[model samples]
Structure formats: C-alpha cells, structure tokens
Target: MATSTPYSAPLDNEKFLYKLVIQLLIFCQGSHRLLEPHLLAIGAKLRSGANSQELLSELQAVSKTLVHISKQAKQDVNVGEGDGAALQNNYLLERLDELLNDAEVPLRFQHQTSLLKQRVRANLSEDSYKKVIDSAITLLLNIKDYSVSEQKGIDVFLGDLSDRLDELGQDVEIAGQANREMIDNRENLNTEIHRQVGSLKDSTQAAEELDILKNQTAEYLDRLLEQLLEHKQIEDERQRDAQEKIELMTKKLQELETETETLRVKLKIEHDKALSDSLTGLPNRLAYNNRAEMELKRWKRYRAPLSLIIWDIDFFKRINDTYGHKSGDKTLALVAQLLLNNCRETDFVARYGGEEFVMLMPNTHAFQALEMAENTRKMIQSCGFNSNGENVNLTISCGISDFNESDLHDDVFVRADQALYQSKQNGRNRCTVFAA
Candidate 1:
C-alpha cells in the first residue's frame, strides 16, 4: 500500500507556490506597464548623446533595483497588500531619486528637479508620487538636449583625424614609389655604361680606321656621359621631390599626433567635468562610487581600518528657500571648502548628492572618522556665510560607519546612510555612529 499522503503534499504545495509566483509576476508586469509612460517621458529628456548614456545607465540600475524589490516582496507571502505595495513603491521612488539625482542632471533641469526631489521625499500617497513622477517627466521633456551637438563635435574631430591619417598614408606610399624609381634609374644607367664598354675590342688595325673607331668611341662616350648626366639630374629631382614629400608627411603627422593628443586631453577634461559637481567643484556621486569600490577592495585585502562619513548641510533646503539658489550654492561651496580643509591627504572627500558629502577614510576607524566628522561639523557651523547680505550660520549632520570584512561597500554605505537618518531624526546638527 502507498503511504498516506499529507493534505499539504509536495505536489499541492508546489501548485500553490506556482500560482503565487504567477500572481506576483503578473502584478509586477502590470505595475511596470503603468509606469512605462513615465519612463518613456524621462527617456525623452535624454535626447542628447552626452546625457543619454549616463541617464540610461541610471535607469537600468533603477529598473534592476525595482525588480529586486518586487521579487523580495513576492517571497514574503505574509506581507499585507497595502504595506507591501507602499513599501515597494517607496523603495522604488527612493532608489529612482538616487539614480535620477539632480546633481548629475544637466544644469538647465536642476532647478525643476530640485523642487521635484523635495516632493518625492515628502510624505505623499502613491498617487501623489505618480504625479511628481509625471511632472518630472514633463520638465525633462521641455529641456533641450545639448549632448547631440556635443556628440557632433566629437564626430567632426574623429572625421578630421581619419582624413589626416589617409593623407599621411598616401604621402608615405608616394614617397616610397619615388624612392624606388630613383633606384631603378641608377641601375639602368650603370647597365648601359657596362654594355658600351664591353663592346670595345683590342685588335691591330690601320691608323685611319683606328682613328674612325676612336671618334665613334668618343661620340658614344659623350652620348653616354650626357645620358648619365640627364639620369643623374632626373634622379636628383626625384630624390628632392621624395624628400619634400617625406618632410611634409612628417610635419603633418606631427600635427595630427599633437591634435590627437589635444583631443584626448580635452575628452579627459570633459569626462572629469561630467563626474564632478559643478556647484561644489567636488567629485560627484559617480566618482565617489568608483573610489569607494577601490577603497573597499583595499580594506578587504589588507584588513585595514576603513571608515565612511556621510554628512549633509542642516536645513539646506531651508537655506535654498530663504536666500535663493545662488546663496544656497555659496553655502554649499563654503561647506565643501571646510570639508576639504579638514580632511587628511589620504582621506577622499566627495559631494555625494545635493547637500550631502561623503568622506572615505582609509586607515581610520569609526572613532577616528567620528572625530574628523565632528571637527568638520563644527568648522562648518562656525563659518559665517554672508548670503544675499544676510548672515547665515551653517551646521551639518554626520553619520560614521566602519567597514567589516563580511560587508560589501554598498552594505557599509547603507549602514552609514542609516546612521545619518538616525542623526536627522534625533536632531539636525550632530554626528551619529552606526551601532551594528
């Protein structure tokens, strides 16, 4: 007899699981469909080649993050519908906010985006979030895509380079052909002289006949000399032409090489600019990510003390709202200067986003980072920012976290961010360290 099967048999459980998975998948698909318009509208903003690449990269990251959240929610079957949805949407919007950061966006769109970011962070319903998303898309659509023109400039440079290379190759080929022609001319001249000499014989003859032969021989010798002279002149002319061609090619090649180098340097400068925050003149989020990864690797390999400090200007939005963006910018610049002044040579400081700044401290533990952060905070607090003829005292909130062997760089960052959130919650102007 077959063993009695339990009510929750493996097949039955599998069937239930399959249905649940399907439902989750359907829900995710439907949700993506709903947001597709917003995504497309945002994509429309990235019409320029220069901005499109970074924007698309961020979009891809955000999409992956959303997918991950959706899958995680799918696994947790017990999560309530409203709570799960709100959680997923909140996380999605937050991740998007980070990905579609205003600091990274074009300057023309920054003002609109800065305001949108505030609304995105506000306590709003999912519907309100959707409205904010739509507004963001609309604003992005209105901005002109300048990257297209920038890309055209790059194309023109590349085209000129290619044309120069082709001209150089042709010049080289012509010079070689000219050289070979000169060599062949000399060889032919030598062969003709040799044949003319070999034709003479040593035999006794009458004086008159011998004189006639001498005359003929003299005439032939004169003709040969003239021919040799003509060949020499031709060869000289060819050689001169070839030398000139070679010299021209060399000069052109040098010019092309110099131009290529200039273009490369220009591209590098542009890349650096793209990775930098214009307002603060500090390395931006993209640069921070790269450096953070490298620092994390070093810590993992060497077991060195690595600490992260995240700080934000206290009431920065208020500063913006009160004194105008220019004043806000001045304040940010002041804070950036303070941070740079306080940091050690080994410490890497970067503008993480909007008002936030990050410092990666190698060979420093959490306590050390905390001390450094406190100093920075105090210095910023004491700095008097005279913005729009108003005296503004600035302060910052900081969060400090240290690296663990088991944690990824992102893990460490999340912990630091959490500590920052706690600091903000406790009060705006203080430093907090991650406990766990």
Candidate 2:
C-alpha cells in the first residue's frame, strides 16, 4: 500500500484560502481594480458556497477602504493642522502594514499580489514594504543570535504574554471553583445549624423529665469534648490547603519579578535599536527629523528662539579616498562624539547623513547658533582621530537658520542647507546664517 503524506500549511497554498484573500484585502484596502480578475478566477475554483460569497464581499469592501486610505495618506503629507490625526492615521497604517507585513508576502500568484500592491498604495512603496518585511523577518529569526542575557529577556517576555493568557484561563477556572465551594459551604452551614438546633431541642424536651434529663445532660457534656476533637481535625485540613495556595502564590510573584527585570533590559535594547544609527551608534536621520520637528513645534508654541545648524566636514570624500572607508568611518564617529560633547543638555544633535551633523538649539538666536557651531569646529580640530595608524584633525562648514513667522519645520531644513552652502563658499570651518 502507498503512504499518503499528511497535509501541512505554509503561508501559501497550504494555508486556508482565506489567509491569502485577507492579505490581498488588507494590502489593497480591498481594491479589486487590479486583482479583481484574479479573485474571480480563485472564486471559480471554489465549488459554489457561502464562504466564497463572503470572500467576494470582503474584496469589494476593501476597494472602498483603499480609496479612503489613499486620500488620507495624501492629506497627511501636506497637512499643517498639527493635530493627532496624522499620528492616528499612522497607527492605522501601521496596523494594516503589520497585518500584511506591509506587503512583504510573496503571493503564490505574484502577478496578482504585485498588481494589487501597486494599485492600492497610499504612500506604501513596494521597496519600503519589502524593507520592513525583510527587516522584521530577519529580526525575528535571528533574535536568538543575540547575547544570552538579551535572548533570555526576549524569552521571558514572549513567555510572559503566553503566561498571562494561561493565567486568565486559570483565573476563570478558580472563580468557578470558588463559586461552587461557596455554594457548598452555604448548604453545609445551613444543614449544620439545623442539626445543632435539633439536638438542642431534643435536649430541652428531655429536660422536661427532670430526673432523666439530669443524667442525659451529663452524658451530652461528655460527648462535646469528642465533637470538639473532630472539628479541630477539619480545621487543620483547611489550614493546610490555604498554606499550599499561599506558597504557590509566592513562587508566581518571584517569577513575575524576574520577568519584569528581563523586560526592562530588553526594552532598552529595542529603544536604542529604533532611535540610534545602526552603523555609527549616533542618532539616525529619522530620529533627527522627528526631534527637529518636535523642537520646532515647541518653539512656535512658546514664541521661543530656535536655531538649526547644519554642518558638514570639508573635503570628506578626499579623506575617504586617501584613507580607506574604515578610516573615514572612524573620522565621522570621532567628529560625532566631539560635537556631542561640546553641546549642552538643552541642545539636540544628530548625524543627519554622511559627514553631516545637524543641531537644534533651543532659545538660541543666530549669533548663539554661530557660537555653538564654532565651538563644535574647535572640538573636532583639537582632537586628532587615530584609526589604523591614520591620524587626522577635521574642519567643517556650518549654516545656521532660525524660525520666523513664515517658517515651517520642513522649510527649516531647506534654509539651513542654504546657509551651509554659503558657509562652504565663505571658507571651510566658518559659520554663516541664512536670511529669510
């Protein structure tokens, strides 16, 4: 006899057809414009059923939602409202993106999925979606490759999520058990109370016969000691059960605390991963943009002076060519640290890009921004960076721009860039200010 293999599921055909359809719906916002024909073909393969109808309806609904999502995405790009609406939209997109891994899934029918992803993008690019999916998948699979402490922290957290669900189940069971126990106790108490009353009544009735009651009362008093001994034994058993529960509770609490410490450590690592540059360990460009925008808003709200200084090392490419790329990287790192050390707590600094640094100076005017820039220049000049026996001091050009009534956050960048160009023309290592 031939053996037939048991069927298992991959994200592709092996999984329920619904998974593929749901993914398409989420990605395209259900737009059938591109994938409608393909969906129809999939429907034809299914024997007529209620499930097929549901799939068809979902696909139709997604098309409508995609239209709305597209409009919203465009609106956010140019919106000046500064409300939480953009953030909310971002979260919605993130939820949808997470559902599909932002279009990272290769549809078994790539022709259909590719067409759908192309048509349904509000701001979703295939490359970006691919990047996010690639990154997350890579991170997930390789997370175990991290240091033991780090991996342990992750294990504890993932375990905690599952544990919480199990705990919820256990709590439900315990609650039901408690309810039953309470009912049983109530019934026992009522029965015991009735039995004791009956005994008292019998004793009273007997007491009416004074001579017989006297002998009976003495006998009943003797039996009371024996009954008390039985009650003591029952009480001891109850105490033991309570003691066991208390010990189990203590162990659970200790495990929870250990999990908490591990989580704190894991969170710190993820935070740095998200906010800092992977290569240089300085703040990344995305962090710089977000921070600068926040600073601009704060300055606008309070009518405070805020200046942005955009600086780039002079002849950076020459250095890279003269020394290897490794030497160039160390120089950049060295310059980043030097600039960082020279800035104040109030000042925000970041590596904007290759050989470029941007700083946000709160409550600072053009003159003050210039002074800070000059100080940064001196710091870099003072320290000779040594990497692989190549020693070099750095010179940089800086452009300063300040916020005014007409300036928006995006414009702040442009103005700063202009000033940086002017500073380069004036002389390297000098600071120049842009006039609105």
Candidate 3:
C-alpha cells in the first residue's frame, strides 16, 4: 500500500480503466440517443459528469426514470375528462370476461370477444389493439341501435297516453257543462212551481173575499155573482195553465234525471279506462299506485302483513319478434286473465308495464306470496300457448316481498323488483322471495 501512493497506479491498470470508461461513455451516448425525448435532463447530467461517484449517481437516476416510465405506461389511461373517465385495464378485462359469460349477448358477438380476449391476454400487440377497437365500435353501434328502438317505443307509448288524457279531459269538461245545464233547468223548474203555487193561493183568497162580500152586502149580490162567475172562469183558466206547467216541469225533471244517469255511466267508463290497461284489460300503473298507497296506509294502521309480487313474462320480446305484435298483445291478455283467475278476491293485480305485472296481497306473508307465485308460474308454463300453428311455450318469472316496519311503498316495490331480477338471473319461469 505504501508503494502505490494516493493517485498512482500501474500502467496496465490505468489503460484498462481508461478503456472501460470510454466503453461506458459510448454505451451512455447510445442510450441517450434511444431515450433522449424522455430522459433529457438525466442524459445531460450523465454527459456532464466524469467522476466515478457522479457517474454512478446519474446512472442510478436514469434507471429509476426508465423504470417509472415503464410502470406508468402499463397503468390505466385517462380516457376522458369527466365521469367514468379512467379506462382501467383491469376493468376492461373484467368486462370482457362478463361478455363471454353472459348468455344474453349474441353468440357471434361473444365469440368475437372470446377470441379477442384470448389474443389480448397472450400479447397486447398492434393486431390485438385493432381487434379491440373494432369490436368495441361494433358493440357500441349495436347498443345505439337498441337504444333508439327503445326510445321509439317509449315515444309511441307517451303519445298514446297523451291522446287518452286529452280524450278524458274533453269528456270531463262535457260532463261538467251538462251538470251546469241540469242545475239551471232545476232552478227554472223550481221557480215555475213556486209561481203556480202562488197563483193557486191568490185564487183561494179572492174566492174567500167574494164569499165575505156576499154575506155582508146582499144588495150588490147580482153584481158580485157576475164578477164571481168571471173570476171562476179566470181561475179555471189559471189552473189549467198551472197544470200544464207542472206537467212540463215533471217531464223536464225526468229528462234531466235520465241525462244525469247517462253522464254518470259515461264518467264511470272513462274512469275505468283511465285506470286500466286497454290491451290486457287489467289495472294499470296508475291503479297500482293508488292501491299501493291505500295498502301502505292500512299496513301502517293495522300492522297487517302485506306482500307484493312482481311478475314478468320471460322472452316476451322474442314472442313479439317471432310471432307478431298482435300475438304479443294476445299473450299479455291471456297472462293477465290467468293472474286474475288465480288471485284471491282480496289480492290486487295490475299491469305494471309492458310484460310486467304487479300483485298486492293483503294480510299475506312473503312465503305465501312466493307459493302463489310459483303456482302461477307453473300455470303459465303449462298454458300451452300457440302462435301460427306452432306451439309457443310461455313462462313467467316472479319476485315477492312483504311489507316491513318503516317500509315505504316504493321500498317494497324496489325489493320486489330486485327479487324479480334475481329470478330472471337464476333462470326464467321461477320465483324468488326477498329476505328483507
């Protein structure tokens, strides 16, 4: 150690060190060329330093920067700037898995997704990227088409509802006007009756006056007798007129009563139409809402067990597509009748919407409701529906929920709907009861 002083080394060792440093500088320059855009500052630092410690530090910093860039590139990309903006890689994978598993998705689409998913799993190359983009675009286009179709159906329903409401309003206005006219007629008849009564009373008073005159002044009896005779004639004429008026008023009152009855019938018809589904001839959503409110009040007051069941026709859209809309309508009507037949007198059934029915069972628990739903399901399954001379098997799914303490009307409905979804998920033609 004493022989080799502080900065002194063998000539061979010095040459090897110089060669090694030169080789390191060449390697760093090549790396700078490859990564200059990302590592500008680090490259500059590395190039500006020559001391061993300084060089070692710069190399370490460059390695860390490269590592960080690699990790960041592998993370989720910001797809947009608002809600659901982050395009998580794991989420995409999960969605692909779901698409593959979901039987509802078309087999062709599922097949495409399955192939692409496998390729993506193997290698995220340019080919895989293109495939993913193309598949996503196709799927989105289909979704848009389906959404447009659904919106069209909704628009049509709303238009029909508006028309019905307008008709109902016109009927109500007419009824009100008829009522006002009836009131006026009644008032007029009363006035006429009072006038006739007063006339008869005046005639009687005049007759009594004539009698008094005959008893007090016998000398003017001849004149009084003539006047009395003329008065009698006038009184008879007045009586005839009053009798005619009374008869006319009685006929008018009868007519008014008849008109009133007719109006009552018309209003009842309109009310029924407003609260019922025209196609299925079952109570509609409005009726359901009213009934639910009443039932909720009853449950609150009496602590009665109230159960709700939500039923849906399985593959209803398929029926419409395969047979026709007319067949779909027929199916809905048949199902409604079936439900009505099976339901108890106290149970309220309504058509919630297209292919959906709601049942409100008073004083029934969830288990009883479930049993009833199962029976209904079996009935529908065995109904042996036919369309176009081909046997079309119809089935229904049901969900049941009972009223709980502190439960609102909508809460029960939501739970029932959730259970219905579970039934559909588990398999069609089955019933599920909500536990809570």
Please give the CA lDDT of all the candidate structures: 0.78, 0.67, 0.71
Q: What lDDT is obtained when candidate 2 is compared to the true structure?
A: 0.67
Q: Model 3 clash pairs? A: none
Order of the predicted models by TM-score, top scorer first: 1, 2, 3
Candidate 1 positional error at 90, Å: 17
Best by TM-score: 1
Q: Per-residue CA lDDT of candidate 2, range 1-436, in tens?
A: 2333333323334346766765654564445455565455545544354364556665565566567668877897658454565556545444443333222232232354334323323454546655544654554344334445556867777887688658756755665565566566557655765665577669878676777776776665555555556555655565566556556656776787787777778677666665775445678777887887788779878989998889899888677657754566677777888788888999988877667888888999988888778877877777777656767767888889888886887787789899899888887878888875
What would you estimate as the lDDT of candidate 1?
A: 0.78
Runs in model 2 deviating more than 4 A are 1-160, 163-165, 168-206, 215-232, 278-280, 382-393
TM-score of 2: 0.56
Top-down lDDT ranking: 1, 3, 2
Judging by TM-score, tell me the better candidate of 1 and 2.
1
Clashing pairs in 1: none
TM-score of 3: 0.50
| Better-scoring candidate (TM-score), 2 or 3 | 2
**Tens digits of per-residue lDDT for model 3 on 1-436?**
8866655656566556546655655565655444554345444644675445555555566677678756665563332332252235534644553343221233234465556545544434446656775776677577558657656865775586566556656655655565565566556555655655565555556655777644444534444455557655655665565566556556655765675576568557757766877667788888999999999999999998999999999998788668765577688899999999999999999988778899999999999888888888899899957888988889999999999989998888899999999999997789999865
Best candidate (score: lDDT): 1
Listed in order, each prediction's TM-score against the native is 0.62, 0.56, 0.50
| lDDT (C-alpha) at residue 231 in model 3 | 54
lDDT of 1 by residue, 1-436 (tens): 2565664477686556445534544455546554455355444544443243355554565567688767876867656876788888877776656555534566566787778767866677867978987886776555434556667888998998898899988888888888788778889988988876665432223335867788767877887889989998998888789888988988998998898899899888778878888778889888999998898888888999999999888898688667765677688788988899999999999998778899999999999888888877887788876765779878899888999869998888899999999999998899999997
> Which model is ahead, 1 or 2, in terms of lDDT?
1
